[model samples]
Target: MSSITVATWEQLASAFYQHGWVWLPHFLSPALIAALCDDLQQQQLRSAGVGRQQDHLQNQQIRRDQTAWLDGSSSAQQDYLQLMQQLQQAFNQRFFLGLFDYECHYARYQQGDFYQKHLDAFRGRSNRVLTTVTYLNTPESGGELVLYDEQDQLLQRLPPAAGGLILFESERFPHEVLPATSERLSIAGWFRRNNSLQGMVDPGT
Candidate 1:
C-alpha cells in the first residue's frame, strides 16, 4: 500500500495505545482497496443496529452491505480469506486466530445523516474484540471518524479516504461516525482470538 507503512502502522498503534484509537491512513494497498470498494458497492447492507437515536436521528442506511461470512458468494469471501492468511504472516498481526464473522457495509450519508457515539459491542452476544474500518469512498465534505477516550475527550480525527483503514480495540472507549454533509462508504468488522472466553457476554455485562 502506497500510504500504509510499518512506521505509519507503528504510529497508529502507538496513538491507539495512548488514546484508544488511531486513524491509520491508507493501510490497504490501492489495488486491493479499489477491488474491495467495488465489491462492497455491490454487496447487501443494513442499518448497524437499532438505528434510532435518543432524539430521533437516524443512522446511515446501508442498503448494500455484504455479509461475506454467510453469503454463498465465493469470490469476495475467498478474497477476504486470502487476505487474512497473508496478514497472519506479518509479525505485527495481533489476533492469533483467523477473523471471526465479518461484514462489508456501504454507507451513504445524505445531507442530514448521522450516527450517535457508541461502542461496537453488545450485552449478550459473542463479543467483538477489535473493530476495523476501511474507507472505500469518501465524499469531499463531512464524514469524520472521531476517536474518543473513556473520559469522552476527542483524541483525533480520521478523515475519509479510499484505501484508508483504521483499527482499534472494540471493547475499549466508545467511538462513532460523525454526521456527514455528504455521503460516506466504509467496511467495518472485527478480528477474533483463538480462545474467545465463553459466557463473556453475561459476565462482562
Candidate 2:
C-alpha cells in the first residue's frame, strides 16, 4: 500500500479543525479496498450492538447492521492499521489531539438495514474522540450517511462510494445510516484518548 501524503494529512487536519468533520474521497487505495472486501466475504458477522461493553446490547430497532471487529489477524488488516498509525501521528502533531489508540470493525448493512441517529461517545463517559468510516462498496440505493449539526439540523447526506472516507468528531456529530436497498460494506473506527481510571485504562468498545 502507498503512504498517505503529507499534503493530504495537512488537509485533513485543516478540515477537521474548521468544520468538525472531513470527507476524503479515495483515501484508501483500490488494491487494499479490494483485498479487504475479499477478506470480508470469508468472515462471519454478528448483529451489531449499541452502547459500550456490558452496556452493549443488540437493539435492531435502533441499529440493524452486522459487524466483525478487526483484530490485526490478517495482512490486509495490518496494512490498514499501519496507515492509521501514520494518521494518528499526523493528527497529534497538527492538532495536539493526544490520541493514544485506534480501533475499528468491519460493518455491513444489508437490504432494509439502518442505524438510527446516534453519537459514538458521550462526554465524560468514554475515550473515543474521533470517528472514521471507510466505505468499501458502492451500493445501488440508500446507505447514505446523514450528519447533523449541534442543533440537530441536517448538515450533510452522503452516499457510499468505494474508497471514500467519512471522518468526524465522534461526540460532536449526530449521524445515522439510512436504510440500504442493497448490501453495503465499510470499516468503522475511532481514535481514542486514554481514559484510565486509577491504574487501569478504560476498556473501550
Candidate 3:
C-alpha cells in the first residue's frame, strides 16, 4: 500500500469536523485490507451488544485490544499502527479532544442481519467520538448504511464498497445497517479524544 499523504489526512480532519463525518476515498486499499481481513481469526461471533435492535438480522462483533504498536499483532495491526499515527496527528488539534482507543473490530452482517438505529457513544462511555466502519466486502444486494436526519428520516444510503468507509459522530447522529440479502464484511471501531472536546477552538482560527 502506498503511504498516506499529508493532504489526505488534512482533508479527512476537515471533513470530519464539518459534517461530523467523512468518507476518505480509497482510505485503505482493498487488497491489503482484504488480505488482513482474511487473516483474522475469531473464536466465534460473540454477543457484544448493549442496546436493543429490531429483529430479522444477526449481528456479530469481536474486539482487538492494543495499547500501541507492539502491544498486539493481527492481520492489520501494523496497518492500524499507521492508522493511529495519522489519526493522532490529525485529532491532536485544539478543537477535537476525543481520546483514541485501540479496539479493532470485525463485524459481519449476514443474511437477514441488521443493526437498528443507535449511537456508539453513550453517557457512561461518552468518549466514543467517531464511528468508523471500513468495508471489507460489498454485498451482492441489500446492506446499505442508513443514517438518520434530526427528524429521524432515512437521509442517505451507503452502498457497500470494499475499502469504503463510513465515519460519523457517535453522539450527533444515529445509524444502522439494513438487513443483507447476502453477507456483509466490515471493520469498525471508534477513536475517542483525551477529553470530549465538546467546545473546541478551530486550529485555523
Candidate 4:
C-alpha cells in the first residue's frame, strides 16, 4: 500500500466516483510486473470456461484463452494480493462496498484468441461487486478490452499494457477482449461481498 500513496488513492476514488469504471496506468511497480510475468509463464493453464462451478464448461466460440488461478504461492503473488487488500480497504472506506475478499487468476491469450462480450456478474445472483484487471505484458497490437454501457453503447476500448490496471462495476458493464495479434497476458480479479448463509461461507470461484 505504501507504493500507492494517499494522493493516488484520492485520485482513484475521484475517478471511480465520477464514472462506473476507471483505468490507471503503471499501477504496479516494474519489478512486481516483471515477476508476475515470469510467474505466469511457469503456470499450468487450461482452456478457460464460460460459467462457474457446476455450470462451467468450455465454449471456444465465446472465449479463446487459457487460465490458472492464483494462490499466493509465490512472493510475487503475495505482494499482488497485499496491494489488492489495500485497495479493498480503500474502496470499503470510501464507498461502503462491504467487500469481503478478493480472487484472481492469470489469463493468457495467444494469437487469434479472444473473449466475446460478457458480464462478470448478474444483479441479485452474484456476490462479485467489482472487477479488476492488471496487464502483465503489452502485446504489439490487438487484445484491447472493450467496454459497453447498459444500453449496449460503446464506452471505451483499452489496450493492454504492462502495469496498467482497470476497475469497473462487475454487473454494470459488458466487456470483451479483442483477438490478439500476438500473445497477451493479464490477471483478472474480483472484489466480492460475503453471501454465506446457514453458517456456511459462500464459495468463491
Considering every candidate listed, which one attains the maximal lDDT? 4
lDDT of 3 at 116: 67
lDDT of each: 0.58, 0.92, 0.63, 0.94
Question: How do all the candidates rank in terms of TM-score, highest first?
Answer: 4, 2, 3, 1
Error of 2 at 102 (Å): 0.5
Candidate with more favorable, higher TM-score: 1 or 3:
3
TM-score per candidate = 0.67, 0.97, 0.75, 0.98
The TM-score between candidate 1 and the true structure equals 0.67
Lowest summed lDDT across 10 adjacent residues in model 4 is found at: 1-10
Candidate 2 clashing pairs? none
Across 1-205, the per-residue lDDT of candidate 1 in tens digits comes to 1323468646765675675556666566666666666666665554444332342332345222222322326465456545543443331354233444443344555565666677765444345566777777768977788878767898667888876777777766577677777767676656554334584522211
Stretches off by above 4 angstroms in model 4 are none
Itemize residue pairs with steric clashes in candidate 1: 43-64, 44-64, 44-65, 45-64, 45-65
| True-vs-predicted CA distance for residue 66, candidate 2, Å | 0.6
Which 10-residue window in model 3 sums to the lowest lDDT? 62-71
Tens-digit per-residue lDDT, 76-114, candidate 4: 899999999999999999999999999999999999999
